[model samples]
Target: MGPGNRPLDLEWLEDFLALAESGNFSRAAQARNIAQPAFSRHIRALEEWVGVDLFDRSAHPAALTAAGRRFQPLLEETLAQLESARIKARAAHDQAAASLLFAATHVLSLTFFPQWLGGLESQLRLGPIQTISDSFHACEDLALQRRVQFVLCHGHPEVPGRLDEAEFPMLRLSDDVLLPVSAPLAGGGGAMHSLDAAEAAVPVLAYSEPSGLGRIMRARMRQVFGEGSSVPTLPQGVDIVFTAHHAALLKAMALEGRGVAWLPRSLIAAELKSGALVAAASAEWNVPVEIRLYRQRADMAPAAEALWTLVQERPPGSGGR
Candidate 1:
């Protein structure tokens, strides 16, 4: 077959390059660790494929013919390009293997993920990470669809979410409290709103339906008050003046004295500490919850698996890193 139609072997190209470099068939064969006859046949086959005599056999040391000379630079460049392509392919594969993907509820992503990841970094060498922060429902969809390796969010055992129903493996990373909080009263005396207020309806900054926290809060409120009670089931009636999918947003409104919001202790710790916010209700009104991480049951990339292993190894109540 002519060069255009021939099935060219890559080894032949390598052998040809070796021979051109050494200019001696015997030495090139030795360098290639191939039998001399086999090496000569490879060169002959390559030359035939190219439709030209690539080497002047009569030279003191075999020399490239005019066509071989032209072929040499092109072959060298082609080989270099192939090697580059090979390296880049391997690098891309390694990066993908080492990378970790996560979906987190917006509040935890902002308030918890950074410190937790930093703690893990102290123990393991992690690769690239991409975290998608969205509403709880969105994060659950990502996890259920296997679009992310892990999902981080709040959970209450009594109020199991879709991930729980799906039987996705989970780790309770830490304990958190969902408690009523509000901006400090004028002159920083006390909370601006109270769960025990006897007179007026308490203005509440509430979570939207899409929020995982909203689900847990609603269920827990029903259990605490009574199944017969309606929404905003606190002992004292409430008026939900604002609703949002993120605790951070509710917190911002609370700071402005807008209303009381049941926010995660982790998210409002700074506010509570600095007196920018205060408990709107007593400890009896607090709802206990878990900071949970869930993963698909299917096999994951090595880095993700390793993270799961580390999380499993941590002692119960040890804040997950």
Candidate 2:
């Protein structure tokens, strides 16, 4: 806490505690995924509010001042209890509170999300649900604002700290495919004969840019095509590929044979199994991604927990830790 300029914001108290525990602003920012400068400001605001020097500036790794030490456990327990109460309140109003918002990469939205909900309903025995899609951080914002009870997204390098990392015991659905697929049954048939023929004939459908799947495909394509090569085939028949967009649109495009489309095997499983679509190459072209559910350690509602538990119990072939 600083020497008194602002009233204490309990939220800052939490940030102060996280900073104290981590002891490095950069790491703390990464853990928080906010800019370090912004996090520092929050810490400063906290100190200003509390009217005390919370940490020893001269010390390395940010040791807390006597005042901070004295205050830690009290704040932690108090916040925990307050959060517990919030969860109960949410459960009591779950049906009306039943408004849920989560995000997913296109693949999850297309494939597993639907499957998971069906399973979630069967498990929780719920009827009618609401959901939305956006990038991972959007879910983080919504949850922080209490706009959503939960979030689901692909696990990535910075994921653990970006969202609250609780054990969301998952049931893995069948590993899905995201190989190039085509809408025109005839267009797809020729590519099935040989891998070389497939690569040679069509521009591999790829996510447009700056996306996880797109990044993976770009690196892999370079490795396969050779170093310093530009996107091996141009106009590679992109049916407007975007892994971040809605899955249903991608699926519709592939089903229409707009071009060779990379999409989830799980979403197109029935199509592929029925021979309506063919993998552009073998399954080797696609990467397996996760669809984990998350709730903050302090903010899960009972109905939310109930939904999570249902998600946890389903066949977890695809949704593992």
Candidate 3:
């Protein structure tokens, strides 16, 4: 409410502040980019709205009255709060427009996401990105619940997961291989653990059920080995030493010469090259998998949609490392 109980014009508040700061009507009018008479009218309207005089006109420098002195601080505080609210509202809108949200499995988040995002940045402009790295099931849940724009994880066409079952749109970004690897023996002669060993039961570092790689390995191992085989088969038997949902965790245990573990080739390429980790089995045991990005079928943010378009335009193996 304002003078005559009409709505107040926000410009009048600005005029009041300007006049209070300058302490001169003409100077304040010039500062506010309005004519002197118009600015004076704005100040008068504001005073009427407040139901009191705000300036002592007889003072040498047009000083504030006691009421004006009290009003100045309250007005300054109110204006400051409104400006803050305006800034926050704009910032939130901008963030919603420019931000990208992703949920990636632990392995891909570490081994693949940074490089893949760098490659995309070269082709398109991306804003702030938020990535959640967790187990496959967690990433799947984010995608299913519409909490993120994309999910990056290993997938096999033969073994469809929840995202696939829900018919979420996905792009096969790259190819990856999960292969058996073991730390080298003490004398550096060969791998410490071997799938073909015929001695005591072979120790195995395996994936838990929550891991996407675990699901793929279990399903494919059944096809490669007999119907009942879950992990890679040893000539004698396999003793499950440890189970985890993270490939990097299994890689650490494998590097310590703990047991034979199936790890992604991309993740252990440096180790394989340096002979820190060696092939525990032949190439026939390697499982080929796809590094896939899944998203909801509905429209997404502009940046996400643009990224998906660029990925589709590129060649199949261009982004794989």
34-68 in candidate 2: lDDT tens per residue?
78888898888777766777888788998889988
Clash pairs of candidate 3?
none
Q: What's every prediction's RMSD, in angstroms? A: 10.6, 15.8, 8.4
**lDDT by residue (tens digit), candidate 1, 1-321:** 358877899999999999999999999999999999999999999998999999999996899999999999999999999999999999767658648989999989888899889878888877899889999999999988877889999999889889999999999999988888988888976788988663778898988899999998778786332365333446556777998988889989999999889999988878788899999888878888999999989998888889899989986556542
What is the C-alpha local distance difference test score of candidate 3?
0.87
lDDT of 3 by residue, 172-290 (tens): 98899998899998979778998865387778888998999999987888633236664455557778889999999999999999998989988999999999999987887788999
Better of 2 and 3 by lDDT: 3
Candidate closest to the true structure, highest TM-score: 3
Candidates' C-alpha lDDT: 0.87, 0.59, 0.87
> After TM-score superposition, what is the CA distance of residue 72 in candidate 2 from its true location, in Å?
41
What ranking emerges by TM-score with the best candidate at the front? Answer: 3, 1, 2
lDDT, residue 121, model 2: 59
- Better lDDT candidate (1, 2): 1
